[model samples]
Target: MNDQQNLMIKVVLDNWYSSVKRSDAIFNSLTDEQLLQEAAPGRNRGAYLMGHLTAVHDAMLPLLGLGESLHPELLEPYVKNADSKTDNHTPQQLRQFWSEVNEAVASKFNALTTDEWLQKHTSVSAEDFAKEPHRNRLNVLLSRFGHLEYHRGQVAFLKEKTD
Candidate 1:
């Protein structure tokens, strides 16, 4: 890649990490009681949302051609259904899982090269990606960043609850 291309890739990655850090701020603001409290009526609570975000981040490992998940068991419990028992795990355990998984996601993301960010992810073969190159690591990062922000918005109601 040329200098400008390399710079652009780093810019995007940096912005993506910035967003994750902002979400972490919101995630860190919760109380043990707030973890179980619903961010809003008719919605899943903070604990479930934390688990779901962790599961999503874990899925990105294999998707980014990194490696197997550190928490594959989280899939069914967190991703397969949103109606999981709110008390399935203690608040402290859920908080630890959230922190651990996000750190794992960041470490794997840092291992990728600038060119690899433009390459097709593990889900698409090179031939197919050749036909549609927009489906790349950069794209996944953009979408997942949006996913984090979306849940971050959901959790914003926690502050509202406290107010």
Candidate 2:
């Protein structure tokens, strides 16, 4: 890979790593009850958010060619009700799940080539926005990161409320 591509990859990977670390640290502070508590109406609980974040990593990993797609059905759940669980698990279980997801995300990211990073992949179609011919892989990754960050904020807010 060229120096510029390598630099970009490093920047993206480093930023992602930092974000994940910060998120995990924040999540670690919450109690099991707090993680499962619903912060607002029609919103997912912390457990659901954790599941959803991992699910996104699971889904995106395959698209990046790091692993096989295990659960296509999980795509919808990740986007919609990832954090809205009917039953709750212990804090240990939640942390284990988060670890698995983080590993998967890191593994997938590590496997990417510069060309693959620049390649395009189709993302979810939104009727509300103007129809686009296609969405790139970079855009897909960015959108997932943005979504995670938004939910991370919500998780923090919920944490504060419960504290």
Candidate 3:
């Protein structure tokens, strides 16, 4: 890669890393009970938000050709019980879960290559790649970052309400 391209990739990765760190700090301030608490009547729990962040990271890894899966098992706990009128994680479990997932995501981000970052891949389902267009790796990465930020905001707002 050219120096400029390398620099750009570094910048992007660095920004993502910074954001994740800040989000993690915010999450760390909450008790496990708070982490699993629902923000509102129909909103997601804090654990669910963390799980969604982790799942998106896990899902996008293969698309980037990184050849590693992250937190596949934990995905269901975050997404499956939504709207079920029950909480899925205890406060302690939520804290540990977010910590583990956040660590995995940071590790993955650190290991990404410039070539991988620029590659294009289809986010098609098992049966749909032939019919769907490919998405750029950069776009996918940005989307995940944005997704994390979106959930972070929700969690932060919930923290305020709960506090």
lDDT values of the candidates?
0.83, 0.70, 0.69
Per-prediction TM-score to the true structure, in the order listed: 0.92, 0.76, 0.77
- Order of all candidates by TM-score, from best down to worst? 1, 3, 2
Tens-place lDDT per residue, model 2, 1-163, is: 7999789878877777878888898788888888877757677778778777776777776665456654445456555544436754555765786787688777777877867776555344445223552354566677777877888888886666443
lDDT of 2 at 124: 41
| TM-score, predicted candidate 1 vs. hidden true structure | 0.92
Best by lDDT: 1
Across 52-118, the per-residue lDDT of candidate 1 in tens digits comes to 8888988998998888888888888788988464576777887787778778888887887788889
RMSD of candidate 1 to true structure, Å: 1.6
Q: Which pairs in model 1 have colliding backbones?
A: none
Off by over 4 Å in 2: 69-85, 88-91, 122-134, 161-163
- The regions of model 1 sitting more than 4 angstroms off are 160-163
Overlapping backbone residue pairs in candidate 3 total 2
Q: Between candidates 2 and 3, which one is better according to lDDT?
A: 2
**Ten contiguous residues with the weakest lDDT in model 3:** 124-133
